[model samples]
Target: MRKIPIAETLIEKMLFIFTVAGSLVIFFVIFYIFSNGLPVLKASGLSFFTTGGWDGQFTSAWTAAPGQEIWRFGAVELIAGTLLTTGGALLVAGLLGMGCAVFLAEFCPPRLRRPVEACVRLLAGIPPVIYGVVGYTTVVPLVQSLISDQLALEMVRICVLDGTSLLAGIMVLGIMITPIFVILATDALETVPLAYKAASLALGVSHWRTIVKIMIPVARRGILAGGIMAAGMAAGEFIAMAMVAGGVAFLPNPAHGLLFFLEPVRTLAANVFINSEVLGKANMESALFACASVILFICIIFSLLAQLINRPNLKGGRSR
Candidate 1:
């Protein structure tokens, strides 16, 4: 091999420096969020995770220090709502999207794959805000009508929640994320070695069995990574969820749960959006930052959990 020219080497080194600089900007931003966020966290203590209360006025009346109560926004409800909606969305998106991916990858004709892939990509490109609008106008009304009729028949004590319920948020998020799962899974399935399929077929194994026992096992990490990405996307959703999540604060009850499908629920992202209007107010501002910090922590935890779950499969991929 010929040695690189000094100028070319220097140019490559400069490109890497630029990339590192960009990465450090993001790293420092996260550090700043954690730093500004830590003081409130320390002051709030464990109660931050336990208590659902967020009334700073009530906190101030009993305070020893002025401006101290600004740190009192407990993030439990926001955290809970965020998890519930994101989990619900992931469950729906994973089942539907992965199944569709499997079919497209394993069963569909090669002639049909290109068009189908393009359609899925098109769906994925639709903005999250549009999904929210659809959920608000279409999904919420449908849910309310069905829920009202069902509650009338099944339970006497039913209270109808407006359309901004957790269920609505989940449904919107699921639809929004389905295309991602399909795209990722389809790519993964395509990457599976054809020799594996041929060997299983030669052994007289059913196609379904081969897919279940061999192909899926091998592609598990990719599928899992797709699922985790979908969940992360759902958690970060703001515009569409903001439109349909109703932005209410409370731990949902099973009894009132159906109402969650109809009523509005606040997510961490939505809280940040709604509260930003009062950003100049010290308590409200700090509270929004606290919520942001908690959201970041939750996202980090979820990502770690996904990696841990997929560790074996990821290792298997490396070995192969």
Candidate 2:
């Protein structure tokens, strides 16, 4: 082999160092959050995860009393809200994004595909704050109006007096994550060999049947990976969610019937954001750090899931 250039060798070493540095940074962050938060979690015990209600003043009082038990720092509602919004967002994004992806991959004319795809990608580039502003101004008012009707309000037992609610958060997050699904699913679909589609068609399968049975199955791994990523993003979304989630830490009352979505809620990420300023006050900072730890755990779980789903099979090839 020819001798490598000095510049090339130096560049390779630098890249390896940078890669190692990035990984170390991630680990350092996880360690820092856990170190700061775990003691509070231990102190709170099981109640932290099982109960709902966060009174900073009460917690501060309790913190002042050294021997008194610390209670009311629970995060059950935050967890529930995070899950509800994320699940609803996934459902909405899945349906709409997959449909758009299928249409773009199979039906759109060549000339139009570029422009349409560009539009979807543009959505991914839009800042989360913009989505928050739009949701606060438009979706909130719209939800408020729709639920304000006497018959609808009575039937659903609307809990919120105005627009900011779980429904608004879900809608905003769904819209925010739709572009992720569209882009990834479109790429996955496009990667399915044309030969697969042609073979199915040659065997007397209809175009729709070919897509449903052949192309989609072959591309499902990418679609699922995209979904996992979207879920993580939805779970950790702050600004947009905070703007529309009503900023209250309370479990959605099932007694509200179909209008439970109208109830105000606060996600774990929102909890950390809303309470971030109380760094040295009571146990608030520790509690917020705990919320952050949970969020980090959730992100880690999603990442692991994506890795498992995307792992190559024993045959040394990706699953179809």
Candidate 3:
């Protein structure tokens, strides 16, 4: 057996202790949530999962009117609404974000890169509430006007899709998440060794072609990693989504068909926010906790996915 240095041994023990402490903290929190949250599920049975409505009071939420305090809970609608907005945001963000990252890392002049990257990162630092406010004040009105004009031109009946809609939420969320995508993905793209770039250029490969064929493959995993991070952020986002998604706990109106994008929605995080604010409601508390538990599980899954995506790089490094 090889002798170990005393200092190195102490560091190893310290690291192990820190890891276990972190795990125990997570375990305790999860245990606490589950223990407190399961009572609602037991009382409601499968009906809680089946029905798609929220019949709780939101007296404290200034943006929403005071709703009835009747004790009732179901997450189907919330889940649907949340998924619609979050997925829509991801779709919008993914396209613009990936393209921006590619251009910033590969095509932009070296002199312009820093300022542009700084502008994108500035977005990431802004408070989520600011994004919500901006979306509500600006994007919502614009969307409403455009959609209203189109319907008027086609002689379609006027719908009350006044700014606070699934479309607005998607727009706000996508914009907020884009910075995350650009920052992480740009780092990944830059990490591709210069030798590979030089070799491809020397071999008469066009700049765009080499980037698509060589650099992309090497950095694909990291780009995906950025997407996963952005997805997690979008899913957890509440303030902006609540502001733009009309604070209704239902799917888009099916009447308009494609106009569903203009419908109001309710999300899990927003539900938690509303319900948690109302005191003296044990059942609602438990139900909201259940929603929180679900969101937590989703976050955990995204984290695991990020780790799995990075494993190929890890394995390759070890082999080499």
Candidate 4:
């Protein structure tokens, strides 16, 4: 046998080292965030979650001047806004995307499916900033004309409100994440065994009924995973939501029903973007990082719950 090349051995060693290092770096970053955020959590206690006030003025004896006091960071408004907008987006995206997935998987011809699937992926490639600009110029004006102007009919003043309200944010986010759900659901639907479909058909079940009852149930786990991913996209979308969510600090009322559509809203990431300059130091920035940690935690919990719900054997049904 020829002598082993030293270069090849070195390259293999380098690649292995780099991969392990990269993985450890990711873990380290996560650990650092949690460590830093713990202070805020402890300071906040239970009230941090229940109360939406973020007063950044506390007196530290070591740092306080004779008459000066300073406090920094606790942003419940941002948290609430982020959740509401993302949740609304998830609702619309999930329904429309799952519906499209069902149609594509069960009804469309293979030739039609290929192009449709390609288009769905293409939608995911569009930039969030572009979505924001479109929302501002087109979507906001339409909302103002159709809804705000109508409300103005009874009032003396006509306000051209922000197009970045909670509803607008939801619609934009829904459009953004729809592709992921559609693609994933479509893939899952395809994996559903043809035998099941045939058996249903042999039993005289309608084509639509077979798809609804048999195909969907089998692919539930994969579809649910895709849904969780879509929700993550919606939740983490900062630039787009920042532009379109009106960035109000106080929470909007869901009980106001459609009023949420008209009013401005803020999200946690949007808050970080807006108020990173608070106190002219990195204190607020660190606080924003803590907020990000919280969002990540929420996403992790949601994914866990989805996994629990979507487990194949949990329903005691056979999966093909």
Candidate 5:
């Protein structure tokens, strides 16, 4: 091999070191959280995950006094809240973002594309706190007003006493993740071989039909990968969910039907964040670490799903 430049060799070594360091950091964090959290989960037993309420006192020691009952720490409601908000966000973001991506990639005029893409980038750059503020000030009031109508409230059997609710959290998270989907899905669509489009047009297929039938199918894997990433983001969201999720750890009653979305809730990520200040309480801190561990598990699952969806076939191409 030709002699590599000294600068190039140094840069390559630096990159290798950085990659290893980053991976080590991630592994270290996972190890730390699990090591600290698993004991608490074991001590709490099944009730830790199955029970609905969270009642913990700040005891400097690990055990309670001789006549004092142990505090209860449960995550059933938090888990439900996380699933509801994340699933709802995915539904809303997937539909809206995929539509926008398809439009931008296939139909938008060249003149408007730049501006629209810029707008998407701007939206993506906005901080989560700003989204929370907007949801608290705008969406919360809007939902409250809509549910305040006696007929509508009665029809849905609205249980939310205030505007902050699962619906509000879902809406905020949906908006937050939409830009990610739009960017990723747009890129995926744009990457479809130009020959595919040319062949479809030559076959006399309409542009829309070709897109719907050919392009989308071909790009489904990428779209799904984007969705997995968006799901991870929504699942891990804290500030925005905290602001609009009503800070209540209560499972939405499925019997309420559509009004189930009106229930106030709290998510695992938000729970960890909300309870982070109680690190001095041994059991409580361990429980929060357990919550973080659960979040980590969720992220790992999403990552694995994305990897599986993007895995290549034996034919040396991405799986369909």
Candidate 6:
């Protein structure tokens, strides 16, 4: 063997060191959050999640302020709110994005692809605050006008059901994440070989059937991966949702149904931002960290799910 090149060895060692360092950093961060958060969880007990009345526990301070003796850390309402907005986003984006992907993959003319692709990229690049502003002005008004007065009054017992509600947040979140789903879905579909499409068509299958039976089957993993990624994106979004969701942590009132989406709600990310700014709670720091941990847990789950669906062994609907 010839002598090893100095540049190659040096570069390899340097990259290896960098990769290990990056991994260590992420590991330490997760470890730190769990270490700090578990004690608070234990002290707070299960009631921290089950009971309502957040102010009752957080209003009192052990140091700077004094009012109550107990600390309330109930996050059930936040969990509910997060799920509602994210679920709504999934519903909206799933239909719209998947439809767009199909249109682009199977029907779009070459001349139009550039413009449409540019628009998708632009949508992805826009700042979350810009979406927040646009939703607050446009979607909010649209929703307010669409709901019947009778339904609004019925929901008022639980929340304002006004311009700023879960519906607005859902719409805003859906629009914000649509580009992500479309891009991923498009990429997934693009991976299928043209020969597969031609073969299916030659077999006397309709163009529609070829896509449904062949292309879609090969691309399902990617499509699912896109959805999971979109869910994760929706989960992490706080600014746009905070603007649209009314930033209220109230649970659905007993009279309100479990599936109520017409009322105001708050997500875990929004709650963390708001509660961290609160001055009354003595354990505010710990509680905020716990909120962060909860979000991290959700993101990790989505990441794992996306990975599981898009494995390298299943090469874009083709078997090696």
How much is the lDDT of residue 150 in candidate 4? 51
The candidate, 5 or 6, that scores higher on lDDT is 5
TM-score of 2: 0.91
Candidate 3's TM-score: 0.83
Ranking by TM-score: 2, 5, 6, 1, 3, 4
Cα-based lDDT at residue 13, candidate 6: 100
Off by over 4 Å in 3: 1-15, 56-72, 147-160, 253-255, 313-320
**Which 10-residue span in candidate 3 carries the lowest summed lDDT?**
56-65
lDDT of model number 6 = 0.79
**What ordering of candidates by lDDT runs from best to worst?**
2, 5, 6, 3, 1, 4
Query: Which candidate model has the greater TM-score, 2 or 6?
Result: 2
Report the Cα lDDT for residue 33, model 5. Answer: 92
- The TM-score values for the models, in the order shown, are 0.87, 0.91, 0.83, 0.82, 0.90, 0.89
lDDT of 4: 0.73
The clash count of every prediction, one per candidate, is 11, 0, 0, 5, 0, 2
- Candidate 6's displacement at residue 193, Å, is 2.5
What digit string (tens of lDDT, one per residue) describes model 3 on residues 250-307? 6666777867887678788887775566544665677778788777788889999988
TM-score for candidate 1, please give it. 0.87
Q: Which portions of model 2 show Cα errors greater than 4 Å?
A: 56-72, 149-159, 314-320
Q: Judged by lDDT against the true structure, how good is candidate 2?
A: 0.84
lDDT scores in order: 0.76, 0.84, 0.78, 0.73, 0.83, 0.79
lDDT of 1: 0.76
* 130-243: candidate 2 lDDT, tens digit per residue: 999999999999888866567445544434447788999999999999999888888888888888889999999999999888888888888888899889999999989889
Clash pairs of candidate 3? none
Pairs of colliding residues, candidate 5: none
Higher-lDDT candidate among 1 and 2? Answer: 2
* Candidate 6 lDDT over residue span 196-293, tens digit each: 89998888999988888888888888888888888998897888888888888877553656335567788888877766665334366676676678
Candidate maximizing lDDT: 2
